[model samples]
Target: AMHPMRSEHIRAAVKRARGNRKEIVNKIEESLTHCLAREGLEGEVLGREKHIYGIYQKMRGKRRAFNEIMDVYGFRIIVDKVDTCYRVLGAVHNLYKPLPGRFKDYIAIPKANGYQSLHTTLFGMHGVPIEIQIRTREMEEMANNGIAAHWLYKSNEEDQPKGTHARARQWVKGVLEMQQRAGNSLEFIESVKIDLFPDEVYVFTPKGRIMELPKGSTAVDFAYAVHTDVGNTCIACRINRRLAPLSEPLQSGATVEIVSAPGARPNPAWLNFVVTGKARTHIRHALKLQRRSESISLGERLLNKVLGGFDSHIDKLSPERVQAVLAEYRQSALEDLLEDIGLGNRMAYVVARRLLSESGEELPSPEGPLAIRGTEGLVLSYAKCCTPIPGDPIVGHLSAGKGMVVHLDTCRNIGEVRHNPEKCIQLSWAKDVVGEFNVELRIELEHQRGLIALLAGSVNAADGNIEKISMDERDGRISVVQLVVSVHDRVHLARVIKKLRAIKGVVHISRVRA
Candidate 1:
């Protein structure tokens, strides 16, 4: 019964009783002593008893009953240094035949919660896979008590030297902050799960430093983890000495380097895929600042353009009076108010009204709100119920909270809103406004294999994005297809309908209306 234990020492006295229950417990305690006495290890070796949750996970994961599983009794080895952890790993590997793929080097990468160790499932003399973990004394301390080591020990002032576990904890706490702002508790818990069980890839920096990140992580994540300033300016990235897409997935052992630009900022779409909290937070922060800057620039441009048309200058409006009016509105800054006006959230005419009243300048009723021309913006929304394009005669309704919602003048709900003039609003598309709008069309075609392909080709020939398509058999000879497609306003809608109608066996094509 004599054997080597990694975290603790199996004492001489316990070796005599091979099958005694109390003696087995004593042997585990003795193993802890042997490991703790080794040079350069720190922390106490308190055998960790398996909790209910841990037992449940093992049983459920293996689809086995509680009594069928073996080796529930395991002892934890606590150490004080990262380097010592590797040495202990070497010692254990030398002593046991580690089951292939059962050895994990978490000491180098660490977990989201900052736990790090060399974990191995080894074939002991008893011919069973016994789990053994080797860790530095510091890692052992963190495992016993989570998140308290930040103040428990006096540490270096350098950012990274505070330990990877501390860094990981800070990152998780930041994620918790974001989750609170998101206001979804379920989503918050789900995000925490993602952080914990992340499928990870380990890569090396050119300088020989190692980084462990979630699998499929991009170079953008790597850049941000290096430093926020570096992330902000990341222009390009190289993996293993070749230029790669910023969104390219990283392998477990690639070498990565970031190429940066001085003034580059993160794109908003980066939020769609980034895995780490550090990268996510930095990208979100950069995007927020960028949006603020963009809004301010847009506002200044619009104010200059509008005032220039009126033969007046923004400076002539008197900053003091503007500030006073803004204070009444509970706005903190003039630029913020101006940005709101430019973004169509706040009407310029309203701000103008406030300004005119405060400055004691007599002015006539304005032509229209800055974005909407009178009842025009109110009555001209493209209704999902009818999906009217530009060619359709559209009417506006004064929808509560939604401002003006437009519908085809002949929309089925027209009677309901028309009867209530209080909810009616005048609206029209400006003469030169140009953009693509979605419209749904119903097509009747013979049951032919090429019909769908032909229709798709015709639609593409006219340049449109297919939003949705579905078909149903009406009978043996015909099928009715619903096509939700986009067009450059009303005139283009006619062209596409005509084209689809020209296809062979296409009997009829007409717009779908409520």
Candidate 2:
């Protein structure tokens, strides 16, 4: 009482309060337990940095005022077992009513960093919020030191690296794998972008091993996480023991199994559906490799046709001359030059002209149309608008960076450019175009029971697959059906149309071209 109101007196007071910190903690715990017991709680409140710096950081981070900050007697509940942790949580709630939607059970779905605890905020005495966390002692140590705790653990416990320690080690391993597998820095950055998602879902493999993925991740992401090879060859998936689409978004607790085929490869369309960086990068890399091989092949064919006009062939061109041309084009090899021509990034005509410039040959363009086998991989794609099949008259549009896109010669989209030799080329289907091409059909029919079954049966009878189907009711008596049928060629399409025309109550049917 006689002390002066100076800096020395304030410092002394602060020192004395610091000495009483443990006593204050004991009293707080005692009062907390007493309050919970009074409220009929069966367990004790087991266990925090609302101290100056932590409080300041929170204020800066959340833009919350100092008064809005919550405290739990500046400590969390620490128990010896997971079961006791729940009991303590019940006691805490019995003492203070909980804030709605403020509880998080992270033990079921751990955070991306492998942190697991039960967290909640309660309306404490005086209506202040008390944020509480309940965890075991091991979790407390892991939460405090993170992965560093792996190293900090005493050597005597080296064999107990099964729980938090193993998880942290696994996280390190995953990071290293991601870094090593990235094609470049930008690819690495793209691959890791999914990790930035704050929410994650936990699913199980068919083998019962738990896997964590970003929320909204699909079966494709899960497959890639299993292994790159499994992803590359995966054709279908089973989610929770039922056949599911590869694009189906996975849910927590589901067991996912990938169905792989021996020779299946990644589809460029997969890039449209996949969410993870690893799947995207791997798909792109595989497509790039596939495109290179296809481009080199197509490029060689184009160059040889031009060379044929000059009474020369690629095989006959001297190695030195080829190297000189490669240097002129700044291409490392003949394949590189061909790949450029194939991809349409560099004009085939220009490269052909340069190759024969030394011969002073005035050559007319090569005569025959380029043949399409329908298996040109990623470098060649058929136009969706025209839906050109094997029997349709087609022309190739050399789309830069996208290789070739084949369109019907009569397609309105390419009418102006059909005769432009540089960008468009005459193209014809080979004797055997190997794959099915999608053709849209519009059918008007009297609405009747089992109409869908009849149409499906007809298409199946004609050996056609309906890729998609939709119907619109016109007047409640009539309906218009749109079908996307996949067939081998125009003849095959005609057969399918004939089958549809035979169905009862069919009004009119026609192909849809756009």
Candidate 3:
């Protein structure tokens, strides 16, 4: 009753359509060329048949239906200046009935990648949609080749002319800034991808300098565009001399002024509304630095308190002992080690003990068990094989330079490192432990709709939070789900498991230790 088109037939159909579009392009180019000659405009007119794959990719990327793609047939008109571009647009509109709302003026507001042009779509022969682009010579070069166009031309000394590549240079500088501020290479790549598509709006400063930002950019983004320091200290803004919210989306031709305060700092909530990569990256970096500074201060206080317990002060330690501790932790300087300790990546007690041992001072015995003050930050790690919670009896193993690893007293992995008694330390939970701990569960269930929802609801009902979830469907009716949930302590976690077991279709559930 039905037949599917073969790949060869599909290719043939595409080729035929391309040929028809090319014919229409030729007709439009001829009309444009004649019209320009009559208008005494000095310009070059060119027509192109877009690649079939390019057209298909664009349609798919934009989620457009087949009949909705209008740029399959394209033309370009390159003139001498911005005014000439407008004149050419006028002539083209007069020649063909331009489609309403299909015109865009990129010349006034260049894209993030520095592309500038005037784009218009028109109804050509047989009602086929034809797309046209008008630009100045420099804009045409950038529109076609982007940043590479700048390097294509050189001055007398084989050097780039000053101000000739200003926009492209600014774009590259922004990319570099983003790379420096990004958390990682993957994040930098994501920021670059966000910057690549430039649906932009042009706004103005009080000085009348035009600034181009991504569509949906807020006053905060505009502040960052003006200067990083301005962004860091921005407290309020005024749009067109009227007080506006910092999160207000900017529109074309609006004059924006940033109000600053010395005490103002970036709020994490701003990340939710910022559209520019520069703003996001800078905000993340500033927050990271701020957190590090706070952690360093906390670590200094913690180290001082711990050293006081040993009757030895951090400042009184010998230079050689301090250098030995620094070398052991691969720290270039004492401040770095302290910052790491403050961030909870390094244990202050561990470093202090090492400093005492190196200085030939008597090391303190394991007189009393250490209390876990959830404030230990990054220096403490719970053993994956044990998943120790606050209520569990835990033992700390001081690994070479990796800091303390806490394990449940009954964990099997404890036996592997038990011979080194010197590395083991007794630990107890504090009266006011502050944060949550992670525990994993493996759930087996009969495949049914809404089972995941029920499982999640059970945990939520029991005051547990799911951190991560993964599912594996085996046969037609069987499935296994793995979940990592945060709990207050062993008692809270056990209650969560009990509630999960009560859900229908749950065949089995057990805590995954390793």
Candidate 4:
């Protein structure tokens, strides 16, 4: 009776008296004669006996009984070539019953740290389990010392650093790239340390190249591991030849293909699921750059908006006047001053006044409210409370670090601050506002069979997308449904509501504002 086993399995097997350790050892050695005697396939049989670990640390980290973990034991065979490693595997499995699904050929798909070997679990005599590893002699050394083994191995210079050493060099090069993009020393170390963590899942690319990623890593991690550019523009991923979520946890042996789009930018949401330090570091760097560009654009718009009222344009201002404003604000450049204004750290109105200090003590009243084209990017956000859309009268709230938060003019959340000229300003939707707006709706409807389906069909027919929907039973006959829907504008929303109102069971519907 033979199969695969762990250290615990070996300990349990020994307790059952499965021929003594010497008999097992002799049988394993005899595997060479059974399969690898003449075909230039031979290697040294090395004993890798069970080794114990710190009791307290193992107990605390594994949260398992100490005695249960002591059953591990295995053997390692070091051959001369990669092909022989596999041949010996056949020989060993022939001698001992190898456990099904317990065999792993890391040689085909090396670990992230560049370690390659053939691992198998077998059942020895009397139902005892045993673990074994087979690899080339160089692999054994590389496994033990990793990149540091480079200095220890005294191979001929002509041998060069191909295989393990090359992988190590590539890894080191990645670390240098992370260091360059990291925001600070702490960020660099934090990002670099995660890559040093153990690589547990091995995956493959579409081109048959194997990649080793840490367990729990996502496709974004795989994308970043491929290259920073690929990661930045990746819109989706295909795992194992099928479209999969970018945040899906990767499993070993799955083929991953990243789908990229031209001009597509990294989603800030990816930060939530990305596990690799490289992905995190690169995403943050890209976002920082994106925000800087957005801030500069927004700052220019704000300055120009205010200058409109004083009957002056930012371009019309003299260089000396601009320099004086920067000096007064202790800003090194006009861009810095504008960024501050864009982020709401400095009031644009105040800056506008200072920029015109030389003109005169009295300045003409500013023009109409700033127009929002819905392209302000990260600096400008719509208030979640009111969910304002185009065609609605909106006001801008100057929130520190948030730039502008747009809300319906009637939204009470900003009622107190609305009167404060420094913190709030009127805003008008530009004629060419782009993109959809999300709004939550509460629908009172009769509790009828297939009610949800009807609602969905109606909204779908009206060209509206439902982001989320929840139902609350008011009683046996009536129910209230709350749904988050995306529409292009107020008109689009009205159209969706009208379609829903046509349904027989729908009692009433109104947009949810809070």
Candidate 5:
């Protein structure tokens, strides 16, 4: 009777009858107490009438007027264990007509935040929907205590029976990690939101190990949810005895089996496809490792490519000369320098120039399109260094027998050539972008495992593929991971990034500057 909307309407009707506000309030209070007493709620039944402003907010969200709202009161029932929670659910069902499809058993799977309950909606005396939640006594206490339950329940919480707590520390640990990687209040809120009210889908592994993930999750997400290493190596997955795509969306009560591949790495594009935090986080981690590997590979190629032009081969470049150069650059060895170059933190041209000078070769003129005789458009061409592409403005460079190296006019490699009047030459795509073109992306995320696989899935979903990825650990817990992917066009890139940022752990997503 004291529910805000109902109470207001009742009081207003009473006022129209020339009844006093003070008398109306008193009468309402007496009626509530009398009803509770009749229900055998003899202990202190503390109640606070909802304020007008509170009711106003609720009405606004619900899009209802004061008179349309019901004055139903809510109560919490606390019991002993998993069994008792269902028992209480039965009791509520017996008392009221249980609303079809409004029942959920979260007690078995639990939420990402360790929230466990059996929730049911029922139609009471009137047709109003009343929500009832039943859980163990300890769940009741934890719900009341909230974050404080981490300390109260401790690490052994899940081990206790009945009234004891469940292992809340594991979820707390995830929260703490997110808190660190979370960039701001909004991002932190989003991360917490995933945990606060996660709808779960339960699946079983081939070994009968049960895994629970967020609703609308996929087979890839389930694979990662089982373990980070398992996610990293998951090549293909099977659902209910049928070989399913990794991006296959999962339903409740399905059996999944992950096919493993040794040395398989996560792809950044996966971020564009996965829904759950576990898959997203693991994808990020795997992408980080894959990025490092790609960086190393690209760096080595650049080093070898630069050295290829030199008259003296790398093996013949004299140990003393190599050692002297390393000492001057303050680097440990050639391998370390190559890794740095691949990482994009070091300049390949500068290092190459230095090595050339050390070999007693005069500095080649930064002129005449670093070209060679008769080596027109058919030679080594950069996939456009600006809008570098197979079908864009290109230029040819003379590089001896290695032939003419073509670059897009807008290529970063050619950006300086326009100012050098002697070197400018118009060029175009020789054939077409015959193979993959590498493009980069920068994504923001909270550090967690398995993020790399989700990113890979995203790329795959967009019809793009990840060639390589690297992460620069930015300060303040946010990571700036770079992905080099093979894409068709800008539209494809945008769609992939949009999907990636929409993922749970992704904070921001954008194209990376080459």
Candidate 6:
């Protein structure tokens, strides 16, 4: 049914199927018990007919057709030992034709919820499908009540022995581990759902230890399941003695060997294929820590560079000076301030200026634009309004939240904040700027076939890298083209513009701001 039905409808359906279910269960239990007795096997045989509400809920959850629900009639055979359970399973299979691919051996590889059993669906009299479960008494208790089965047997801690239900205890411990790693309550609950996955594949490690992961899990998931460190440093892996991609889905009984390097780190792409909550949580935690550490280092360097301008150093700063800076920023500690700067949450130079001002030290003033090193890292960003290049005479404006913004001195946008000299910093081009800068140009060209190609070729000839090109058709004959190109310096950009002007169809070319 596409929609859920009323309670009365479900009750009526269960009532109609009750007699058939009882007959099927009785026949299967009789056949199994008789077969086991003849084979000199001793165990308890039980049968169950699921309640109407339980069946309805399961059907709705799985969105299965009414006829597709096969486990309405179930039987369980409980033995004294694990081996006896397997013997019961083999005997049951011999009595009835077993359905292909309809058997699961959870005894060898327990489910994440600590469920262990041998499940088989077989075709019985009149082609009716019946499901049989074979397990030991202990496993029967676990499959029925999960972790609560342990508490039901032991009245108190003193009555319980250590390592009793160890697998269930480990599952509970994993829940706590996920809780600690999750960002919030909702995330913790979501991770718990992933841990309770019903379908799984059993794979082996190089050491021959079995790992039961959810079906469709990748090599990265296996790595994390083995150990967090292994997942973090995993660079490559060999599956069944053959090299395989990390994203490849692992198969049952495959021997997986992780190849890791000390310097290797997690890739963000691992989050896409990993099915286990443990892998996703560990990767996210590692990446966050990595970002924080990098930010701290970058912040420290930026602060030291600013201090060096005043003939001082970060290591030489006294405790009192550091405390004063922290107080100025309203930060509880120095690391917090440094981390904020490193993450671009605060400006390093501003903090340095405030600290020096508090010390009653006269800060040196640049007579003209201060030269840039182009290697300021996260501490400096070019102003979008002017898009200053290396050869331009630029002024540095310290935005309140943004670290530093470099703009051409003649930019009209500079006039708005020029009254506040404290926010205005002198800047000049570095002697050896390391990287190219983005510059935009506007070209008025006569529209013709292959004209765009000619323009692109000319830019390449002048060693300019085209970043983007947007064209507007003013009319069929004329098109206004905007090009964004990467250049080393003003001279290189000027050469590119000259080359573009020499093109056959180009009428005029001018540098566009921003």
Best-performing candidate as measured by TM-score: 4
Q: Give each model's clash number.
A: 18, 3, 4, 7, 44, 0
Q: Which candidate is the best by lDDT?
A: 4
Off by over 4 Å in 1: 1-20, 25-48, 51-53, 60-64, 68-70, 77-84, 112-114, 145-210, 214-316, 335-351, 358-436, 444-449, 472-479, 489-495, 505-508, 512-514
lDDT of each: 0.66, 0.79, 0.79, 0.83, 0.61, 0.80
Please, what are the lDDT tens digits per residue for candidate 1 over residues 143-214?
A: 777667643344546643356646665766667665754435664565566566677788889898887787
Candidate 5 local lDDT, 305-423, one digit each (tens): 55555544456667787777788889987876766665545655566677667546664333222222221222244433343434444564433323234555655665666444223
- Candidate 6's error at 216, in angstroms? 4.1
Whole-structure CA lDDT of model 1: 0.66
Q: What is the lDDT of candidate 3?
A: 0.79
lDDT of prediction 5: 0.61
TM-score of 2: 0.69
Cα-based TM-score, every candidate: 0.65, 0.69, 0.65, 0.79, 0.55, 0.73
Worst 10 residues of 1 by lDDT: 6-15
Q: CA shift at 405, candidate 5, in angstroms?
A: 11
Lowest summed lDDT window (length 10), candidate 3: 1-10
Residue-level lDDT of model 3, residues 349-374, one tens digit each, is 67777878855766564345677766
Question: Which ten-residue region of model 2 has the weakest summed lDDT?
Answer: 1-10
> Which is the winner by TM-score between candidate 4 and candidate 5?
4
Candidate 3's error at 217, in angstroms?
Answer: 2.5
What's model 3's lDDT at 134? 89
Candidate 5 at residue 84, lDDT?
A: 55
**lDDT score, residue 360, model 5?**
65
